[model samples]
Target: MKILHLDKNHPLLFEQLSQLGFQNDEDYTSSKEEVEAKINNYEGIVIRSRFDIDKTFLDAAKNLKFIARVGAGLESIDVEYAESKNITLIAAPEGNRNAVGEHALGMLLLLFNNLKQADSELKQGLWNREANRGTELDGKTVGIIGYGNMGKAFAKKLRGFEVEVLCYDIKENVGDQNAKQVTLEELQEKTDVLSLHIPWTEATDKMVNASFISKFKKPFWLLNTARGKCVVTTDLVQALKSGKILGAGLDVLEYEKGSFESLFTGNDLPEALQELMKMDNVLLSPHIAGWTVESKEKLAQVIVDKIKQLYGFGDDEKKILPPKEYGVSGLGGFFFKTKDPDHIKAWYKEHLGMNTDQYGWTFWWKDKEGNDCSTQWSPFKEDTNYFAPSEKPYMMNLRVKDLHKLLNQLKEEGVTVVGEVEEFSYGKFGWILDPEGNKLELWEPNDRAFL
Candidate 1:
């Protein structure tokens, strides 16, 4: 596949794609107009927040199959329009989740302990330990919004801090041992500190206005490492000044550009931002929550790894697998019971175009990369106890990707997992009991291992 590398990125991404048989063109300096003019020439595009991928840009990229954003947040991209055109959007939020989580925690600690103020005072030759006294994080009820990658990462990091973390997401069944999932109302009522980890969308823009803050039962500390637009700057400033918000730590500002750099000149910044800059109770960073040095390589690696998975890039001995268009991709293995396995196998060989082995009939096929792969078809003895727990006479295996992700999703949806996943030399396997009591086998194949 031919890809357009729009924004500058680590060389490893290009190198990995090249190794995967993908031809890429680097045009980091090109203007949006120029890039749009020739966008249809490539099958894919890898970018950061160099420019917005709106409807017009989507229209220009008629031939684009995918858009890989190097970092998290697809706010700059028109997701609805791209979906209508079937252009897959891929982002690397997993790469920088830890960085963002750590940054958010650091900002919170800085605000809570008055670390920034203490350091500033000491440097100024003023020692006022009593005035700069710190507040304990232990026993505090911290509320987390949007418990996805960043939120979950933050929750994990907070485990040692001895805080009662309550997480609330619009989506339900997201609570785990790390944080107690609760309703937004419950979160607002009980939280001593609130941290935002939500993405910026139309529904979320200015979501945390004065009215939203007023919903809280008491004054609380605030932390936002998500998006600047999620919280209305003016509303937040007023809340902080009024002591409705005790302290605030923000890594992003609503007025920031799409590229997350300064949108306005120093003289042209919004009135609220100017006020925030002068506030002692507020801490601000230039949207660098996920901007760690380690995250640079991680982000690139994640995007490249995703690209490889999508295009069937690794393992030269095994061809790339076909993409599943529906719920299940293909039959992993088909099994049935018979009184006489050998007789049935001979009968199938005599009638159907089948070559049966001692164990089973292995159907071979080439992957997208023209590598070897096979699926097994076998007939077990009628009295075999392999399908024991269930008295079913047959068992079916389904092929899947990201096995753990699918398994977790199933569990969250309250599906009955038969047992834990078992690893074998050939692949990783798991079992689930369907509604009809059929023992279904899920396999994430390791084709190379079989070869």
Candidate 2:
């Protein structure tokens, strides 16, 4: 299977992929038209944020199978479109989770110990040992939000620091044996320091707003190695001014592009950011928490392993490449909605040969061969709002070998495949609406690279 490396940057990734036996096309800096023209010839494509994979690109690709992103975050990729096209998407956040954790810890240590200030003073030939005091991490309660890979790594590192770690995540069952699982309120009430590891989701944008910060019981040290927009800079500045927050170790800031360089020379400073810059207690750095030499190599390996698993490639044939995008992957239970749960369950059982269980009229089916096969379906009230948009239901994509054939089979079995076959640069795919108007995507790739 032919694989095309789209971006010219990240030489280490190219070197790793060369050892995997997959042929790489060297015309890395292709324009949109060039990529669209040649994408159909390749089975696999690795990208960075340099190119945007929109509907046009998806429609143009006839053989594109898998997309490997080298870092964390999917803000640049058209995830829905790729899934609809049946393109397997993989990312390498596992490689950098530890890096982020260590960076956060290092920044916090520097802040609490006044290391940056001391370094500056020493450079000026001052010997004020008495004034340069420091604090200890021992016996402190640290609150961590978004208990995913990065959050878990941070917790692991804190184990030897003699600190109590409290974690609060929207999803349950993330508690580790070492850290205490607590609600947001509880964490806010007890923490001496707070670190954010959450993603940039709709619910998490500006999550650390004014009211959110007001819940803290003490003047806590704040750390944000996550996305910049997660914290409201205005609210943080107010908190700092009011002595509600002792200090902040920030790797990101809202509108940081302007502050990082003198590019916007004449522009007015946002009131909040201007105030933040004047505070000595605040320690700021550009976003580099997950950027380390070791992490870069690790990210490549993680992406390579994911691609190998997705395509059922042999260990010897697996190739490591730096990714251009990043996202989360794991087995997750989904809540489906249907007008007639029983009928849908029966259809899946009879046509798809799926194993399903019912609770009242609702039915749930788990992939027979998967670990979590004991899935169930239950009835809901006629007016039940559980499937409503307000619940923010998840969209599941079932990867199929041949989307057209699968659609035909479902159609023959009296199931409605809602959408027409949409052709994209990546591949051809379609969608179907369940009994409750919930949309599920079916993808089929035209290449063997994603076998």
Candidate 3:
């Protein structure tokens, strides 16, 4: 099958897909019409908000089987029409949910502590503590709209805070222990902070307008990491002016272009957005709530995994890279020392889609002959003795087939062997030293059992 890439992503997305025998091409600078003119040539396409995949585009894609969007939302694509044509719309909400969660939390904390304002004042040499005094999140009620992957993630981040979390979603039974399910009316009545996490649907377009804001019993801070069109910008500005809304932290804005790559393409900024820019209490960012370095790679990986799964091609079903008959096949794992191992692990797992646990990330692939393989990525405590005998800050674990045989060969060649063979259910491990005295780990893996 031929796949067209409308927007570039991490190389792994292409690399992995190409490994599945798919012919891939990139057309980053082509117009939508130009792409449509040649759409029938490809069986699939990968995108990340470069342009809309409307009915017209779908109609032109006669042979297209799937549209794999590297990002979460499919609003830019005509989902209904695509589905009606039997085209699979693949979205990677799972990929960036954690990044969105962390970003929302950061924005909320910045607003609550007046951190942005305080930092600006300090930089300008205007330190007025009383004027910049902030509210505490500990006693507040945080109401989350649309309790899907993104909403649940934001609520989970609030677990450390002494705040009540309420979620309102059209889907029932979505409330978890981190947040209580509540009606929209009840949430409006009690929430001190309202976070929007819904998609851009007809029901949500301009959903948070004057009527919506007026229904709230008291003023509340607003956080929107969702679609910009969900909130009416003029109404939001009016609420901010009237103090009906204490403040707003918006990562997306109504004035954004369809592509979300530029805000106002060679045009003057809208009046409402201009007003928003001048407000000290308002915090704004580009549509980047989920645009973290880690998320870039994760999003690509998710799209790759989904595409592979869709076509019955996957890590366990095929070889990730060709294996050697003798010697190290590839890098088995990578480990490092960190001051905060737990936090590091959580960060990697959340932002990088590592799925790291107590031990760390176990990457699954396959060797030739379709045998499952595993590679580990982990971080240890700063003062740990894990990298013992050698004071190196890191270790390189190499995957080999015959650990004992290789160790014997190295010993005959006068190479230093650091340890005896250690066997486990998943694998056998042995340590050796390089000429420069840096310790290296060798693993004879039983990957099918390890997984």
RMSD of 3: 18.6
lDDT of 3 at 33: 100
Per-candidate TM-score against the hidden true structure: 0.72, 0.64, 0.71
The candidate scoring highest on TM-score is: 1
Check candidate 1 and list the clashing pairs.
Answer: 319-371
Question: Candidate 1: where is the Cα deviation over 4 Å?
Answer: 265-267, 314-451
lDDT of each residue in 118-153, candidate 1, tens digit only: 888899999989989999999999999999999999
Rank list by TM-score: 1, 3, 2
Q: Give the TM-score of candidate 1.
A: 0.72
- Residue 173 of candidate 1: its Cα lDDT? 91
In terms of lDDT, the best-performing candidate is: 3
Give a tens-digit lDDT track for model 3, residues 189-241: 99999999999999999999999999999899999999999999999999999
Q: Which of the two candidates, 2 or 3, achieves a greater lDDT against the reference? A: 3
Residue 290's lDDT within candidate 2 is: 86
- Model 3 spans with C-alpha error above 4 angstroms: 314-451
* Clash totals in order: 1, 20, 0
Query: In candidate 2, what are the lDDT values of residues 1-451, reduced to their tens digit?
Result: 7888775435666776667677878665668788898789988887655566788988888788988777776655678998988988877779899999999999989988988878888999998787779999999999999898899988988888888999999989898975778998899999999999987778988999999999898889999998887999999998998889989999877765421323223478788888888887898877889879888788877877777677666664554531211211111234455667778767877987766666432223343344332222343434555434333344454445666666776778776676489877655657666676666656454542332
